[model samples]
Target: MPADVPGSRSERTEGAARPGGVASAPEGGPSQAVDSVLDALDPDRDRPANVIETHGLGLSFGSKPVLSSIDMQFGRGTITALIGPTGSGKSTFLRSLNRMNDKVVGFRHEGDATLDGRSIWDPGTDLLDLRRRVGMLFQRPNPFPMSIRDNVVAGVRAHRIAKGKQLDVVAEQRLRKVGLWDAVKDRLHDTPFRLSGGQQQLLCLARALAVGPDVLLLDEPTSSLDPISTEYIEAMLAELVPALTLIVVTHNLGQARRVSHRTMFFYDGQLVEQGPTEDLFERPTNLQTERYVMGRFG
Candidate 1:
């Protein structure tokens, strides 16, 4: 049986990973600092590939399994959408993919999540580095309290990457990528919170891009925005999927139909079904999927 997801758009997820050492060297200096890490983190043409793969991944809150025996794959340049009832472990499973579950006190997982074939569960894994590679956008725009310019460069600085004009260049380029450059181009020194909710969200996106991630996770990214803002985000998502792996969790099945390349339906903490978006939405392999999509339950 499929668990019914309430018809609406308000599911969300969290987390991060790191990329190569692009933070230490300033500007255009040798990207060599990241070389050592490249073999392990880079998506270079000849790299072993595979963005994120989980094996028998399970998690529990106080011994009550929140997620169970989860095995999944996230590939480059694709959009994977997580869908399910409000608390069916959809978000739980999503966070575990990047070890965000580790930050939840008392949250424990029985299996492993691997990025680029490296186990994230390893004691020696660098959390900050992992987060950079797996950039995340929250449901709300949570930009740091600072000049837009400063906020965008914060991740770069934290990663010990380039600073000053070079960082500014990266920030600007990312702003352009998110379609925020034209809106806030003149407000680089303005506080981020002052912008409209939608613009602030885009700024946060710009900040994420300044770090150049291979995968980006969006947790109900447009739930709080107006229709126009929602459309903006939806459109941006479509454009971004070609260069970055995107994992979007949403209650809005319509949004899933529009933006996701693949969709997974979850129920009772289990993945009931998943497949190419059009087929799943149009032909629906399972009865639960059919009911949920038709508003019969969920």
Candidate 2:
């Protein structure tokens, strides 16, 4: 695996090491671990601008096609929104990026998806580490059955990025980043189920961030939240860009307009249109895209 790729095993090992010590914090303390985590997540300055690319990608379950001939590139530190009516293959494409559909009963794919200029399905690629670099947040908040703090640091622990007191640092830093620290600080050990729907989602976001991913894949992230919570998540997303890439699958056209720099329209298993967010929404080149954006039909 390329050492420069975020979450690569080599980067993780090197970043977590002190001059003469193992892959853990030195005498400099938890701050060192925190800094290491952040450094590891940063994309290599000389890396290709497009963090992910799909080439003639297609998908099927058994013999039923889901997505076809989908070619796209997701620029580093940019947000692209996938938008379309239900059953339009938007979610399927999103899931394919991280190979989330591989275990489905009859999932099959064509062509390729690449990360950092290498095929994601390369024989040498490590699935667990690939998932670490390409994290995901689902349609609903699915916090683990653990304490709030534990929920936040779950990935960090799983990746062995930090441990002992360092886990606390990672948890607090991530929770604060997602604006959940102040709300859940007093109940760090309490079960996450007690949090409100919005709070739980934020907690999930924090958990995703703790692993220091290079790309984040979101599927209808704000769909379940109220207006206020939705606003909160949207704002948080805006703050993450230029540091982490985001690909979001959403049904809400308005949310797509608000949070994405680029937008793609998928219909009947084909990519109908894609362009800058403003242009795609305001001057859609395709008749179908124009109608859908104008509320003629989903």
Candidate 3:
């Protein structure tokens, strides 16, 4: 297997000490996950970009701040990693990107998050459009109870993508992009629960991709997978990054250094610091960052 998985770690890293000396990362880079399939994105050489930006972004639950004054920008077509110990609100921050936080009755926040400069908080903003543009994947692979094919195409169906053959074509394309197509093609008529945990997660990813989102958000996406499956998803993310803005919140420090273009350190609901992955990892500006990354505590 080729070892160019976009975020391949240095051999000296402890994770590389895999049994039988298997490649610590996935095979042939993450690009292989979706190489043959083409996204429906229009080709405009000078088209404007779609970046996720926020300023003074803060969230509070009943007067208790969960995320306070976070100012960060995630570049379009790049992956940003949010890392910190437990209770740092990493997941909360990710959900806030799409106003998923608003679903909770007591959720309150101050500041604005803009997707491609459009304020997501503005009452005039079309929430359906915003959510469609910024899709999300959960930690566990929770595919619907229906067939694998049906699970992948749910979002497409929600938006009413064409019909019949058109939907099938799009579903196949997205499933193949996430490496689940061949595995489930023959089983498209079978129930999703019949597939392994890993495949279910990939199917969830296919569902997110089916809508042609500009940004993808993951919250501890591989926490339950075995190492092989974990590596597979990591590789898949690398392939997906070039066409989508990716923001990942994980407690795994190694995952951050491997796949992130920018790394942000959060502590106790506050952003301690953020910068280029290498810069932040090598020399953290805040004491909290240094302590957390060095394993003083989770």
Candidate 4:
């Protein structure tokens, strides 16, 4: 396993119950378990290309389970849409990817979530650094209480990615990336709150990108924008793929089909189905997914 996972597989899995309620390894003893572990941990192991993966993932707040048995992988440089009804745990699963739920009251998780084949909850992992690698955009624009330029560079400055004249370059480049530079260039020093809601959301996107994240999480990014603004954001999102992975939680099925390469449907705390966007929409394997996608029920 990775350095952070620590302990031999035998040490971790010995005496653990196997299928059929077996209490321990067979006649070969723990070595059998060790061999299985080695196969799984082998660096040369053949597997699908993925930037983020979850294994039998589960989540709960205190005594109430909110999500269960979520096994999934997110391909690098691809956009995956999470579509489900409200309270379906889509947002919870999204927030868990960056460890945002760590501080929530009664939050608890089972199994593991990995980035680059390493456990995200590893003791050696730096929480701040993980967040930098997996940045997030929220349902609405939430600009900092500072100048427009300052907001764009807030994360950049916090991470010390650039400074002095370089900060100006970073801010402008990111702002332009989100297509907000020309509109806000004249008033760079003005408060971001004064900008239109759509502009403010774009500014937030620029801020998230300024840190050079590998994966970006968006929760209903265009929910509050006008149609024109929504189009702009959607277009910008398309341009970001194949460079940065995107995981979006959206209630709008049309938006999911428009921008995502793959889609996952969540229903009543379970991952009902997932596959290519077109396949999921046109030929979902699960009845729950079919109903949800066809607008029969949530």
The digit string of per-residue lDDT tens for model 3 on 103-180 reads 897899898888878789989988887888999999899888887888888888888865788888988899889888
Model 4: how far is 105 from its true place, Å? Answer: 1.0
TM-score of each: 0.83, 0.86, 0.86, 0.84
Ordering by lDDT: 2, 4, 3, 1
Estimate the lDDT of model 3.
0.79
CA shift of 33, model 1, Å: 34
lDDT of 4 by residue, 1-298 (tens): 0221112222222211121112344467687787678557644246335889999999999999999999999987678999999999999999999999999999999999999899999999999999999999999999999999999999989998899999999999999888889999999999999899999999999999999998999999999989778777877786676567899999889888877878999988999899988799999899889889999976
lDDT (tens digit, per residue) of candidate 2 on 45-151: 45877889999999999999999989999887777999998999999999988999999999999999999999999999999999999999999999999999999
lDDT at position 170, candidate 2: 91
Q: Which regions of candidate 3 deviate over 4 angstroms?
A: 1-3, 6-50
Pairs with backbone N, CA or C atoms under 3 Å apart (clashes), candidate 3: 2-28, 5-29, 85-298
lDDT for model 1: 0.77
- Which pairs in model 4 have colliding backbones? none
Q: Find the 10 residues in a row with the least total lDDT in model 2.
A: 1-10
Write candidate 1's Cα lDDT for 1-298 as tens digits.
1112222111211111122213234444355555555545555545334688888888898768888888887765667888887888888887776678787778888878888888987888888888898888888889998999898889998997997779888788888888888888898999888899999998888888788888888888888888788887877776565467889988888888877777888888888888877688899989988998887887
Report the alpha-carbon TM-score of model 4 versus the true structure.
0.84
lDDT: which is higher, 1 or 2?
2
